[model samples]
Target chain A: MNVAPNNQIPNSQGLVKGMHEQEVEIAPGTLFDAEEMVINMGPQHPSTHGVLRVILKLDGETVRDLDCDIGYLHRGVEKIAEHDTYAMITPYWDRLDYVAAVSNDLCYVGGVEKLLGVEVPRRAEYLRVILTELQRIASHLLWLGTHAIDIGAVTVLLYAFREREEILKIFEDFIGARLTAHAFRIGGLWWDAYPEFDKRVRDFLKILPGRIDEYETLLNANRIWLSRTVGIGILPADEAINLSLTGPVLRGSGVNYDLRKAQPYSAYPEFDFEIPLGENGDTYDRYLVRMAEIRQSIRIIEQALDGLPEGPVMAKVPKVIKPPVGEVYFSIEAPKGEIGVYLVSDGTTKPYRMRIRPPAFINLQSLRRLSIGHLVADVVALIGTIDIVLGEVDR
Target chain B: MSDEEKVTPPDPSGDQPQQSETSGEKSPQSAKTEASADKPAPPRAAPSDKPSPPKAAPAKKPSITSEIAGDPFIDKIKETFGLAITEAVQTLGQQILRVNRDRYLELCGFLHDNETARFDMCTDLTASHWPERSGQEFEVVLLLYSTPNNRRIRIKAPLADGEACPSVSGIWAGANWMERETFDMFGIKFDGHPDLRRILLPEDWPGHPLRKEYPIEYRDNEWTDKHIEYREVDYDTSLIDVKYGERK
Candidate 1:
């Protein structure tokens, strides 16, 4: 059998396309010194988090150039939003980031409310904070589990999912769904807390800190975990911001910008919490940052619950939602990063154009920058660290 | 629509003008003039003629509120790029500037590097199609934020149907995928984009799915016929209809 030339490698579809067609250049010494091979990592690989196909150009074991081919989970969400009414679109937002459905719902709901200028009641505002903070913790826990599992620590997945199940049970009790809980309305929450909602939340919160500590005790000092994670995929602060990275990914690079603080939305201003920053922007520092964020989320949720006000849950919003002829860009700090909704309403029942600034989509762009010099195995670590959801990225 | 019962106080009383249909035309405020300039041709702003279908009771509630106001930041932008900025308004406390399409890249570079408004982050880049606006139909919106200044400004550039807007991916690297997605959805071109191709849809996809002319439901397309192999499984829809009928 004849071997293909260096430039004309087969792609994911088995089509013989030139690697140069993908706009990646072969490094100077890589062409003459060693034989170069192009390989596809995913679209079916479990460690990719979803159907993310990364075409990596390899020189021996090192990655020379990489390009991501996404959109496998593309559902044309923005196109669909143009046809649906304002109230009907909230469910679709839940499907964007299935793990952090509550936060996605809050971002979309807040954007619509901002366009309409409807002020949510104090009780609803407080409840929104509590639910979103709980969602942030839940999302971080899932990331912790899956990221660890991807890097060869199978025990963490079981431990992390155990705690995640408790949070999902709370979600099921509150909103009647485990995964995609559309727990918010345009103006406020659909239903107020159940009778034992407070007790259930408090019980979960009580056990959360201890559970987090147990995960730390397992992985913090483990030699194998440290060998695989620490000092891997280090992204500096300036590059992270230039790439428009957000959430914990930006925080891990020591950038002190959190939407909850930089531009406070919802009832976050009423509650007190700290924005955690990492000194080194590596896989381990990102891990520490997310763990610290989980604790801070607990603090915010506890404060919101203690100061939960007494009033009507829903605001005085019109039944047929029609925002004025204007455009509003509303964003909230979601679990993976900053999820924004750019809404344009032409004074109609349906949106003229609805664009989602998905954080994972932007953060995933930095994978090329982070994984270029590392081994092929580190590409998995980098993807896990970025924490992308293909549904949101491709939407 | 309770403007009086706002959680955040309604935009300092003196900065905003009294509510009226002709407020944008009547007021001499630079912001109002900019708002009025935006109201002329675009179908999005010309919502007055075909009034929205009447609502039940809140029809009397004011639909148009004058939130446009001049700000010091906007003044600095206006001073730097005089005619490049065609219109400027602050709606719902969002500072929006409509720039001339030819000078868009220059304006973006200025915004990214200027001291007053260092919009280092390009939050998003997407286009809205208005087929009714014949000459200039596509509106490209760029949402930018300053990490150092903790402020955001939105820049909108109007482009013709097949016109190419200058890409800002060189200034902000994250715009590479966003521009590709825009190209994939609306079929808008971004000049000087390093890799200007489809991001979401397949390379062989049929049409720009987000264009105004495209239908929402799925139809037979060339890409599907080529890629997806069909195994004809007779999943009965009549059974589903019968179950739903029984439940009803």
Candidate 2:
């Protein structure tokens, strides 16, 4: 095993080395030395999903060390949370996980609801389930698109985004805004579902399964797609558990844990759906799990629409939310994973402390472990398989 | 082992007496008699004739508080570890325990591995700044969860000016970035963290931006040299006199 020499080689002439010299004389009093190749992956790389920079210390193609640099998109959301009142902060939640705004809203509003002890109406709960499942589909669509693009598959991106656009159009119909839809309020929804909301949802339900079939037709059995994804970035169940990986990443590793099923919330128990599990625990498994999840989410949405009860959306919460002096931590099965909101209330409208348990942030930790010993090119595939949104990661 | 090495009778004031009284002691010989008794007997004295049965070893009892109390895993952890838990707040299967900074990691370690209070998942790490709070001005909160147990716990450690808490990154690899973010935002140091850097702020940025006292803006006149100095110019613009410029 011919390893390269640890130190710079001395030139035959032994002169103090210039820029191009084979060796350079050590500066006096230098006590320690090591050789490492530093590589900066991105503040703008495509696979990073946002302005995330990973500085890697590499031994040839293997990553020996990784330092993740974030905050490029830090809009000071926490500080903003402090400044804004409970009602006003909903918009900030929308931007945190822009792909799945409803889940973000649920995590935050759920905590606030617990703090205020307000019971949302059954209709509102069903509405929340419908919107959140729709948002989950939308989010997973974006993930499938970007993750495919991160790998060499381009057609999936186009097909996934096409379906995602339909979900956004539905969002636009429900709320005036689409991308950053602050549709949820503390007690319930910002407004009632539009008169055509049910019809539009049913319309999507009818169309989406075919669209999902379209996606599967394009990618699932394609030899190239299977070759790229199957058996790549395989995370063992124990390692996944130890790494604290969540969402589909954990499920792909054969963990039968979904917060919606394990600990039901917001009428999730009322709906009938299967908790999808994977066997191989690889990138292909993750893709299959998410694809199945999208289908399941559609089933949930259809159920929510058929059984959509009639009543007020907002519960009769306090005009001003002044929860008692206490703390409450609420978590929801967001599109990515477990999104948690830890709220400490001192009987004030503003929380004493608000902490967000971002799934992307935790999910990203397994990257280095999965990436090591693999080709540098595989880094993108591994990160894609993890399916992180840097907005949530940095937040 | 000599007779002196043989175990002696436990003192009446020892913890075994209290344990026996609470658990209702039953030796194999006494088990049948106790089972038939109408009412459970109080703590029974060791027989006077027989060598005092080696202080009945404390029963290997499962954690009853955790099973019965329905406390969050972390609360059960604090109780089991004997860590002083102060100002507990509980709601919706979530618990927050305020603990001194000194014992934060100890409590975290127990919670991460303990059978009953298995907070195997460290979900989030964050800090809150309170400049006006008297004894402790900075509060670091660790949010944890157990998928198996279906519970959440918040462990809060308060620090003064220079105190540091042991890092939980060893227990949960996910805490690496989170602990860095906490350090970046609140400047609360985790003493044994492998690499602690300002995660969400530039390395050269002045002061912790999230600190209450850190000025949000800089005023002019006493600017640092780095701010004052512009790029060195070859020639004064006013003195130049030529089609292109005066040669240096």
Candidate 3:
């Protein structure tokens, strides 16, 4: 919103002189116009969640023009990927979609695997499914926490984070890191899960359903929550499809498209779960869809744990993978939506070209259209409903 | 289990029949040598030679060209718009079409609103910087997906240095952000994009960071000793100006 002053700005003395002399003439055919007030919503605002700045042109409370300014947190990830070797780039992938770091890792590794023509072991595939599903739940927990707080539901944030901490503990047990887990290797996982991993995951599965119920109990039937969300930011199914919206945001709009179901990867095909859809695409529907997805993710993790295969964790590829001179595009269903890794390898340790298909970046597009007629207060609600992580958005 | 307890087990399903005909015992070093060879001979280490002869015919020949010739979409596109399909690369599920930049917008309009190729979604709009190519410095890649047909097409628009590509924002509103992002990354200006500005970088930032030639870091010449000198500023009056005024 920091508008550079025009080079043709009139001098203050000229402005005062003009005001003093303006009374002399009154023209019948003079044109009058009013400039729209531009307001900036932070490169550091709490509602932005990260370094996202939006410049808004407002007529009172209605948003006339909105410009989203990102890259305040840009670390030149693509440039870094070019410099680093294929094996060394997994950590960078973790940073792209920090919330669902495991999913990001999976997408990158999966793409690299396809390029190298490496087949991952059954155990590795199952482990990946378990970890990714857990990561999805954790990510949704954070979304539920922050999103509820953004909508003025203060207590729900605490409840959501409490459950998220347990998931983080499990992640720590497996990967030895909580937030930026560089757990996935090029062909498979960094190492096999610890002895307690299966048991700990099972314990989480046992308690997660009850914990989800507690979260629902706190907010689902609340009159204020319903009133604030229902019928707000309604995106029709056709419009949602046209806008290229995905994940819960698209499903909430009554589109029954899920990459996991449509194009199953890893052990997603083996898992028995339902793809929850909404009749109406609204802020409320999005919330419901995400909440339902959390339970479905738990079901997948439990099933994966029960039938966890015993085998090697990594594929028998060369230490340094050099894919043929070809381009491969692979997409995975991340917590937010479809996170794709488009890799163009020219038979080298380093990727010739690497492009990230970030779901948040795509979902962020609908904001301007969604916010057109809605009040300023509803803007926060709409953004929360979208559930974007700026790490992925700015990347 | 502890490291001592965890034994590295040998490969499982050792007795089971190999699902693929490709040799399983070949070392990684040999594969590298075969890859580096100028003419990569069709892999000959398979356990049996009878099943491979039929595969060699398709492998040695141009498969993609043949596939494109039979594709109904390519023929329909040619029939509808009279635009020749100059180049086609089919790898995995993605199809890349090299088209004329001059007729790019017209083709996009035909693709999006057209009933046959109802590419309702402009999933992604990105550009690749080819610094070595003087005539064609940037190749704008547009990923279009049709939900009705379950088909995807990637359109490539090669632009010369300092040239602008036609913006598809008018066709699909979703392209607004994607095009802006493409502009921010590759510096390929979109001719008719509304409010075209740097989306991922600061306005005053030097150069497009994604361009292959742009250096990652540069010396901060603006940081002078005089600018770093401490000054006695009123804290109480500065709070409002620093917080609310700057935000406004």
The lDDT for every candidate, in the order shown, is: 0.84, 0.73, 0.76
Model 3 TM-score is: 0.80
Which TM-score value belongs to model 1?
0.85
Interface RMSD of each: 7.8, 13.6, 10.5
lDDT, residue A267, candidate 1? 87
Q: lDDT by residue for model 2 over B53-164, one digit each (tens)?
A: 3344433221211222554544455566564665565544455677777777888887877778777777788887776787788888888777677776778888886668
lDDT of 1 by residue, A1-395 (tens): 11111211233343226544565556686543566667888889999998999998888889987778899899989988887899999999999998899999999999999999899999999988888888888899899999999989999999999999998999999999999999899999899999899999999999999999999998999998898889998888878888888989999999998999999999888878899999989999999999999999999999988888899899999899989888889999999999999998888888888999899998998888888889999999899999999989987
**CAPRI band for model 2:** incorrect
Where is the poorest 10-residue window by lDDT in model 3 chain B?
B1-10
- Span of 10 residues, lowest total lDDT, candidate 1 chain A: A1-10
lDDT for each residue of candidate 2 in A366-385, tens digit (9 for 90 to 100): 77677666777777888888
* TM-scores for the candidates: 0.85, 0.77, 0.80
Model 2 chain A: weakest 10-residue lDDT segment is A1-10
Decide which is better by DockQ, 1 or 3.
1
Q: What is the clash tally of candidate 3?
A: 0
Estimate, for each residue in B161-240, the C-alpha lDDT of model 3 and write its tens digit: 88999988777767777887778777889988765766776554556767776644433323432354764544443333
Best candidate, DockQ? 1
Q: In candidate 3, which residue pairs clash? A: none
